[model samples]
Target: MHTPTTTPSPVPPTNPAALLRAMFDAAVAAAQPARCLPPHLPAAPAKGRLIVIGAGKASAEMAQVAEAHYRRQGVAVEGLVITRYGHGAPCEHVEIVEASHPVPDNAGLVAAQRLRKRVTGLSADDVVVALISGGGSALLVAPDEGLTLDDKQAVHRALLASGAGIGEMNLVRRHLSALKGGRLAALCHPATVHTLLISDVPGDDPIDIASGPTVADPTTCADALATLARYRIALPDAVMARLRSGAAESVKPGDVRLAGHTCTTVAAPRASLEAAAEVARAAGITPWVLGDDLEGEARAMGTTLAGLARQTARHGHPFAAPCVLLSGGESTVTLPTDAAAAANLGRGGRNVEFLLSLGVALNSEPGVWALAADTDGIDGLEPIAGAVLHPDTLVRAWAAGLNPRTCLDRHDGHGFFQAIGDSVVTGPTLTNVNDFRAILITARP
Candidate 1:
């Protein structure tokens, strides 16, 4: 592993929560576009214009970084990037458009149309720098012909509530989007398109990140239909007809249009976890990275990890105390099947749900504390990133008349944490490497 270039200020060992947050901050800092994107930027074309185009929670910052990097070398840059409403950064050359996320809106629809138009008529000498990352799938929305913006919005809402994984979600998205599934890259055909990605999906698959706008897609419309059927997600008849007729087919591999295109994953979940591990090691605490691509139902993940924490805390087996267990990847939450239960659902993201479930399973087990959050600074639809859980988490909940198990049942992890003053809120981190989770076990047995 490469050494972390900077060390965070040491948080006293007595304060595990502080240390956990410190580690999270380090992970975010390590993945910043300014630090990761510059090294992989493509060289300017000697005789042609340079155009920047992208969409994601991190794309704005990515464009800003790319602009600064090229401007330093005396290259003129111009283009557009779409991001979540609150995730935009200042960019002089690249136009920053803020749009809805997790769900498509009219603003996104118009921006996507502009993006598709922007890439047309490019020549061989032109260079297109595509900044892609998590959340791009929704931010860069161009509904397939015959599908309305409202129709696309409904599809997203169904997929979100359907308990589908990111890859599955993107599969559906790609077929429904005119610009996704490598169609955008096809439009930039003949130009040397270079894509920089900060992956927020499991396996770091370029095809799944932002639905691979600038990369060739191997999946077909039939595959997208299968995913929707598996998840029991239904779409409008127009969308169904488009997929059935193969009218929504994406750009495939070996297509000459993408012949000279390139892609690079500048940052990913594993690297961020390793950065946190470095901080933990410097603080005299052993850090164990369980995996960078864990996926499952949110609450179940919490229960399973709680068992590991208990074993380490009680028996010191597999791993000794005074160690932190770190993991990354996307965890899903399957909303309640019952309408009444869904109606009573509280606001929270998957990260807090995992932490709350973990806390309940621990039952205030001494010397075990944890934090789970999204590195992009938004957990689910909430502005809050995630939350923290300490040995006293349950104790505080009880004292405050908050029932952790009940909150878990109602999908109210955010409310539970916020009520107990443990919710971790970091607005607009400007980078995404997926979820960050850490379980710290002190040496006291």
Candidate 2:
């Protein structure tokens, strides 16, 4: 006699919110370091030490996974990894240090200095595995000569508000950082370096993610200066002088010191999007993955996507009803130009800003619902990830005595969502593959 077997049921299509969240959870789960990093980890060195050094929001988790993978093989490892505050994990072999992210602090400076020292004086027999992911650019803070932590922080603050894309921001950051733009890899000369990356930037450019600490940069100092000028971002006189004098140039590509280094992208935005699409398909919802490298101003992208959703809802030109439109990429929020507005700007990140803008443009369109959140779980500086939108979102805002338009104008997506009790909070997901967005358009009654 054979026992009966049953397949797990797909999420009910009626619960659009739960289904969207499940897709997001599935996407994040797909990029986990435990699942992606081990396959890419290099073999242990036969005669010398296996040193692991890394920095990023996911670095600690990656280090822990790497340590466990090797330990199971009877290979002992020792190293250090730096992660954002509250993102550390317990590990015996690799020391995990917590520091500030999206802005550098004293803790990050000390950690960066120590991390650089750890890789110096290594020989050919030594193997260095760099666990790099998003947020390392700030967590691995090593300012160049004549630059202080305050200077670095100022640059980060300015760039965060400059509406610059990740690639553009990192282009400038590579010049100011001591460990970025492949200098960290240069320091590991003679040692075979294996870099495992979880990409969070569009196009999955290794150099843009975490400013490419272990990857050689092809951009020049002149390019960095051009970016600052394009954004009209001001810096201290000393910082300006450093860039002007070409003193902040990074290690260029093809540098012999960087030879024999290997880089592998363990997880990427495209794979995560595909994972989410699979969930949507299983639920009897047709999934349309728009693309994974979308980029633009947050609100602007929101408006554009709203048009697509409206088109699908009204005419079914692009896709039929009961379908999800999914996309992944980093978006920017250029701060308000007015002084008072800038001073009182409300809390939220690009994902929230995008969602709020989409909700407003949607104008409570029937049978339309959406969710947008950062994969890492923290949107902007706040603990909130992002927000969800329903056909009645604006109606509920009006009922709550909150003006969604005013909130969006002030860049206060968090304020609007929180007041409506619609903010999605998923603190410290420990992995970042940039932003996740899904719009579910059900059949109109």
C-alpha positional error of residue 436 in candidate 1 after TM-score superposition, expressed in Å: 0.2
lDDT for each residue of candidate 1 in 1-445, tens digit (9 for 90 to 100): 2333444342337889999999999999999999999999999999988999999999999999999999999999999999999999998989999999989788998999998888999999999999999999989888888888888898888888888988999988998888999999999988989999999999999999999998888898899999988987778888889889988888889999999788999999988998899889888787888888999899999999999999998999777778889999998998876788889999889999899999999999998999999999999898999999989889888999988898999899889999989989999999999999999998545
**In model 1, which regions exceed 4 Å deviation?**
1-12
Q: Tens-digit lDDT track for model 2 on 1-445? A: 1111223232338888999999999999999999999988999999989999998889989999999999999998999999999889889989999998888899999988998889999999999999999999999899898998899999999999999999999999989988999999999998999999999999999999899998989998999999999999998777898999998989998899989899999999999988888888888777878889899999999999999999988988676777788999999999966698789888888999999999999999998999999999899998888989988999999999999889998899999999998899888888889999999988542
lDDT of 2: 0.90
Q: After superposition, how far is residue 85 of candidate 2 from its true place, in Å?
A: 0.8
lDDT value, residue 138 of candidate 1:
89
Q: State candidate 1's TM-score.
A: 0.96
TM-score for candidate 2: 0.96
| Cα-based lDDT at residue 321, candidate 2 | 75
How high is the CA lDDT of each candidate model? 0.90, 0.90
Model 1 scores what on Cα lDDT? 0.90
